[model samples]
Target: MILFCPPGVYRAQSDTELLAGRLARHAAGRDVLDLGTGTGALALAAWREGAASVTAVDLSRRCVAATRLNCLLHGAPARVHRGDLFEPVATRRFGMIVANPPYVPSETSVLPRHTPGRSWDAGPDGRAVLDRVCDGAADHLEPGGVVLIVHSQVCGPEATVERLERTGLTADVVERARIPFGPVMRSRANLLERRGLIEPGDRLEELVVVEGRRG
Candidate 1:
């Protein structure tokens, strides 16, 4: 699908595609929610997979506009909202929730307040957004609903699974991909190494998709 991604909106990458592929399997004929729906890629993918409806939420206004434009361009039935994760849809629940949130560990504990970095930086442990998603997923999901979240293994996939399980959902790592370091990860390789998150010579990072299902 052709999408208009302006300067500030995140371009769809491997993590996005991986999560979208997973979405296609379960989103068909269901109500879907795409959190941090940059460029509306996953939301559009869900729509194409026959989702009854799709709602996309992003913290950036530019992303919200970009998603809205892409939905309009593709004639996809997706509603775009600009707010923090799960905030805009406080009173709503969905059959499925998908997200490719910021999971790149940064040097600081605080999240970025600007563009680009805000799309990928998730504090020192890279769990700032991932943890929030995992913590709140159960409350936002309908009975038998599932939440799919993609993040780097460096950010602790086990922690995510444990968190989701603690929320009363059965969770597991459903997909994984080993990709060479991108600009962000490459830039932080030394830091990650010092922090023991990665080996001294490691250059590739494993991205994992964690799926949580409510009983």
Candidate 2:
């Protein structure tokens, strides 16, 4: 499916994005929710994979508008929502939840603003948004449904796994390891260390794909 993405839209150009597409392939015809649906990348991908319905949510008005336009462009059945986390879609549930939320440490000043590239900042410690996502996911997922999240190991992959487990969700690393730093990926280590978001002895890694399932 083709999406007319705008500038500053954080389009996924990594293996984790590919993992999302692959997950969609394995779960075709399921109802899907794409959180932080910037440019409707994963949302459109799920639609292309035959998801019966696709709902996209993003905090950015530009992102919502772009997602709607992209859905129309691809003739995909996607509803775009403008709100934080899962607020707009509270009354609904889905068989699959896919997100590439902002996972960069707030100490890193490389994130794009809400107007343009608000897709990579995860407040302090880089788990701000991700924590919220994990905390709220169980409520929105149907029985035996899956929540697929794409984040960086720099954002604490093991911590994310633990968080999901504590939230009553079983989690695993679908894909992991270091990838090249984009313009946004730069300076995370230094900034995080400087701000104490990461300790000197911390084993900070790069990027990974985290997948969790609601039991």
Candidate 3:
């Protein structure tokens, strides 16, 4: 499906595709909340999968608009909101919450306030946003609901699993992909190696889909 992706709004990449594949397993006949939605790809995917309802949230106005445009362009139904992480949908709960949030470890500890960096620049350890997602996920999910998050193994998938488990959600790595560095990762290879995130001369990274289920 065609999408309205504007500058600075993340386009569907390897991680997005990875998450969307798993999303098909759980989206049908359920309400879905897509956090950090970019270009509304996951939101539209859930809708196409027969989601009862779809709500997409993003921190950037560009992303919100892009998602809204994509949904409108495809005649897909969705409620698009602009806010950081889950703030826009604070009072809402869903049967499935999906995310392809920023997880690339960056040199800066502070999240980018301006610049395309906001799309992929997680903090040094790459958990700035991931941690928050894990922490607050349990509260916004329905009984028997599940949350799906996709990120790089470089960010420490174990940490994410542990964090989600702490929130009372049973979590584990459900899918994985070993992919070559994309443009962004390629550009940051030196930084990643310097930060001890990757072995020297390593050009490929593993992406994992972490799924957390609430009993």
Candidate 4:
């Protein structure tokens, strides 16, 4: 995904948002939440896709600042906040929620030399962030609302489905994409453990997305 913004504003991009943009079918005038809106990419996309109101949140002050600027750049009335998960928007719920949270695993995550954004970490098994998002998803989604997220095959879509189901939310793989893990974040073993892709003692190699919605 491309990060479009002026030089001064810090920006970050995620392949998850690229997939979310394609999967999001929100209609205009519907309220939407763009969680972890690093550069407000998803929020901007949601607005462009016809969302009536788009609110975004990020844990980093830099991200919040950048999102605000980006929203203005696109003339979008997106409310940007700095907080973890749903802290900033606790009082409000939405018809649609879109996020590309930091699903990277901690053990494998090696901070980039020039990290531009805050939300990319892949977690302890690359599912830390994804798991948290799924756990609290049901409470925030409005009736009939759906959440679109991008994760890796490394996170095990099947497992993700089971987790969401426990919360009364149906899950699906809206889109799938891959990139070799040799480049960024190491720890093939950790990735395999999260996805259960390995045989009790095998190595790992791919990543994918697992999308879900309240049932």
Candidate 5:
């Protein structure tokens, strides 16, 4: 599917597609939420998968506009909102929530305040946004609802599962893939190695989809 990603809006990458594929398997006739919905890729995928409705939320205005355009282009019935994760849909609940948030371990403790890096940099441990998503998902999920999130193993998938579990959701790693380092990971290889997050000469990273279900 063709998508319009203006400068600074993240294009759907491996993580996005991975989560989308998993979402497709269960989204049929369900209300779906796509957090950090860059380019509306996952939202559009959910719609195509027969979701009853799809609501996409992103913190970036560019992403919001891009998602809106993509939805219109495909005639998908999706509502796009510009806001921080979960905030725009605080009063709404969905059968499924999917996100491919930033999980690239960075050199600094602080996440990017502004710039294209905001699309992928997730602070030093790469769990800044991931943690927020995990901690807040259960509140917006319907009973028996599922939350699918994809991120690098370097960001600590176990922690994500634990966080969701603490929020009273049954969580597990549903999928895993070993993919070559992308541009951001490649550029941070040295730092990652120094931090012992990856071994020397490691050019590949494992991505995992963490699934959390509200009971």
Candidate 6:
């Protein structure tokens, strides 16, 4: 599949592919909502998986444009919206919601709004965006709906499960993959080590998929 990622939009990465793999069997006949639909990669995946309908949301205007073009190019029927997480779809609910959000721990508490850092910086603990995904997902989900979110272990996958559970959803880690450090992770290896998020000289990180179901 071909996707166009604008200059400032985030391109699909390993985690995107990982989460997308689970969509094949689950998305068919379901109305899907893709949060943080960078490049519309996951949105297209859901469409390809036979989703009944697809709606995508992104915080970056560039990403929204990128997703729109990619979906249009592929003839994937998806409604692309620009707004913060869950903001664009406040009055809507879906059968399935998927996200591959920023979970990289960064040096600063404030997130980048204009720089390339906007694509991956997730504040000090990397939950700045992750928490919102977990916290607000339940309210936006239909009865017995599923939300699948992927992120690195550095941000605490267990916490995602717990947070989702607190919202009256049954949540658990559904997928796990050990991948070597990417460019961002490699660059921040030292800081991660110093912060004890990673052991000395450890350059590998595990990405986990947390599946939450509203009951």
Residue-level error in angstroms, candidate 4, position 197: 5.7
Tell me the whole-model lDDT of each prediction, alpha carbons only.
0.93, 0.77, 0.93, 0.69, 0.93, 0.92
Residues 1-215 of candidate 2: C-alpha lDDT, one tens digit per residue: 45677776776678446556557644587899988888888888888788888899988877888889988877877888889878999998999898888887765445555444367776767777888888898899998888887787667788888888888889998776556566665556667667765566555455677788888
Model 6: residues with Cα > 4 Å off, grouped in runs: none
Model 6 C-alpha lDDT per residue in residues 76-137, reported as the tens digit of each score: 87999999989988999999999998889999999999988888999999999999999999
lDDT of 3 at 48: 98
lDDT of model number 1: 0.93
TM-score result, candidate 5? 0.98
Which clashing pairs does model 1 show? none
Q: Return the lDDT, model 3, position 114.
A: 72
**Candidate 1 residues 87-162, lDDT tens each?**
9999999999999999999989888867689999999999989999999999999999999999999999999999
- What TM-score against the true fold does each predicted structure earn? 0.98, 0.86, 0.98, 0.79, 0.98, 0.98
Residue 40 accuracy (lDDT) in model 1: 95
Compared with the true structure, what per-residue lDDT tens digits does model 5 show for residues 1-215? 99998988898988887898899888998999999998999999999999999999998888999999999999998999989999899899999999999888877767775688988899889998999999999999999899999999998899999999999999999999999999989999999999999999999999999999999
Candidate no. 3 TM-score: 0.98
lDDT head-to-head 2 vs 4, winner? 2
Residue-by-residue lDDT tens digits, candidate 4, 54-121: 89988776777878877887788888888987889888878887877765555544643235423456
lDDT tens per residue, model 3, 26-50: 9999999999998999999999999
Where is model 1 more than 4 Å wrong at Cα?
none
Name the lDDT of candidate 3: 0.93
lDDT of model 6, residue 138: 93
Model 6, total clashes: 0
